[model samples]
Target: MRELREYLAACERDPACRAVLLTSSAGPFCQGLDYTCLLGLSPDKRRRAAEELARELKEFVRAVAGFGKPLVAGVTGACVGLGVALLPLCDLVYVSEKATLQLPYSRLGTVPEGGATHSLTTLLGHMKAGALMMTGRAITGSEALSANLATGLLWSATAYEDLIAQARQVLDNAAQIQALESTKALIRHSLRAKLEMALHSECRLLVHQWCAPEFQQRVRDLYDGGQLLLQKPGFDTQ
Candidate 1:
């Protein structure tokens, strides 16, 4: 998160950075919180920690959503939890055909954070959002494109580089590009006020859910089993 913040700050300062691309290293974009890190914490400490983490996550999403310049996300593998949430805030998203996206908060007995519930519903609608939360289903990149979660789909990781090149080519036309970006800014500005309210509300609910016994039990199950109980099958290591 600190690194992401620093990168964004640099983008803010650099006039040449017209579009910022976000992607992970070798593994999945992110598996969300390191459940192993939370395994040994007491209930109270866990609750407080979750609250703090949720607040930081909310701020990050807000920053991405309101960034004056366009933001791009390249998702290669597991894009779950806050990963799925944060991508929607980007102006454009590209995902590998093999990538899987999920929102596993309900299965973990915690409320959705990072403005996922609000933002996802706005993008995917109430029914699809509810299905995702309730079933904890993993959707493919092609499915994500169909659902409007992804703007483009790549056949392989190699293809992702080509897509980035294409994106850069389109952005290289400064005058035409700047005009389109200005229009986008105007549209995004109109939605900013409501998005702020939704983000704040999500933080509040997440804090409360973090303190709940059900959520604690879910964490305990993951700790005791050495893996998250509700994790999607193929991704579980243990």
Candidate 2:
């Protein structure tokens, strides 16, 4: 995540960088958090990590959402949890036929991160957004396209080059790139402050929820059910 933060920071600061492109090397864009490590930290350490993680998430959202350059993502496979939370931040998204998006926050006994509460509602409307978050449902690439979450879905990865070329064009042409950036800022300036506040709220809520008694019990359940690492005999989860 720190690497991602640095990359986004570079995109914002580098004059030569006019556009940002995100892609995954792994089979899935993201499989979501490996909660096993987080669920294993000592209570004091867990609290510290959760607090820091919340701040990091807020900073990440602010950096990505406010990036002056056009941001494009090429999703090849599965995109779940935090990955699903991220789609709404990009200026454009292209997905492969196999790409799948899911939000499993409730299943993990937490609420949405990545400011999805506001971004999803704004992009997908109340009904659809509620259905996804409340029901913990996932959507396919084609379904994402139909839902306006993706610009397009490619049948093959060979088609991904075209999207990359399009993003490169933004970086290659200075005047056009600046114009696009200025236009984007003008359009989104008013919403920036609101998004910041919403992200701040999400971070704080998540910090508490992650360390709460219920969340501790849920993690224990994972261990008891053999879903996590070596279990400790006694810990005041409450």
Candidate 3:
């Protein structure tokens, strides 16, 4: 979080940097939290960890919301949890044809983060947002495009490279226009304040939810159900 925030700030200050493209070279883009890291902590420590995470998340979203340049995201694989929530915040999103987006907060006994409660509702209306947040359903790239979550789709055959090339092409063209930054500022001006407020609320809720017994049990259940894998270099569970 700190690294990303610093990079964003640096980019904002750099006159040569016009726009930024966010993408992952690895598969699955992002799979949200590694539950294995949290599952072993005692309830008290767990709550502390959650608080730290909440703080980081709030600051990260604030940076993203305040960015002056056009922000584009390219999703090449599964995007879950925080990944899914981030889609609505970006100025333009491009996804691979095989990409999948899911918000499993309800299933995890938690709520949305990254100002998703406000952003998703604003972008996708009450019914659609409710369906996604409440039910934990996975939506395909085509579905996301249809719902206006994605600006366009990339062919899976060359999705990663295509997304990167396309995002650069688009952003480069946009950067050439002198009014792009001002236009973006105008577009985001009204939404920034509410997004910050929503981020605070959502992050606070996440801290509380992560420490709850139900959420803890759900993590255990996920492991038992073969949904999560425990990596090595295990921490002390005491």
lDDT string for model 1 (1-238, tens) is 5457656878877887777877754457767755543345788787778777776776677777777777778887878787888877778788889889888886787767677777788889999988887888999989999999988887774855665775686587556757757976887775667778878887788777766677767878765776443342122110
Please give the CA lDDT of all the candidate structures: 0.73, 0.74, 0.79
Looking at candidate 1, what is the lDDT of residue 126?
Answer: 97
Which scores higher on lDDT, 1 or 3?
Answer: 3
TM-score of 2: 0.85
The deviation in Å at residue 155 for candidate 3 is 0.5
TM-score winner between 1 and 3, please give it. 3
List candidate 1 stretches off by more than 4 Å: 35-39, 42-44, 173-177, 223-238
- TM-score for each of the candidates: 0.85, 0.85, 0.89
Candidate of highest lDDT: 3
Ranking by TM-score: 3, 1, 2
Worst 10 residues of 1 by lDDT: 229-238
Q: Which run of 10 residues does model 3 get worst, by summed lDDT?
A: 229-238
- What is the descending lDDT order? 3, 2, 1
Q: Give the poorly placed runs of model 3, Cα more than 4 Å off.
A: 175-178, 228-238
Total clashing pairs for each candidate: 0, 0, 0
Per-residue CA lDDT of model 3 for 52-104, tens digit only, reads 87887788788988888778888877787777778877888898878989888
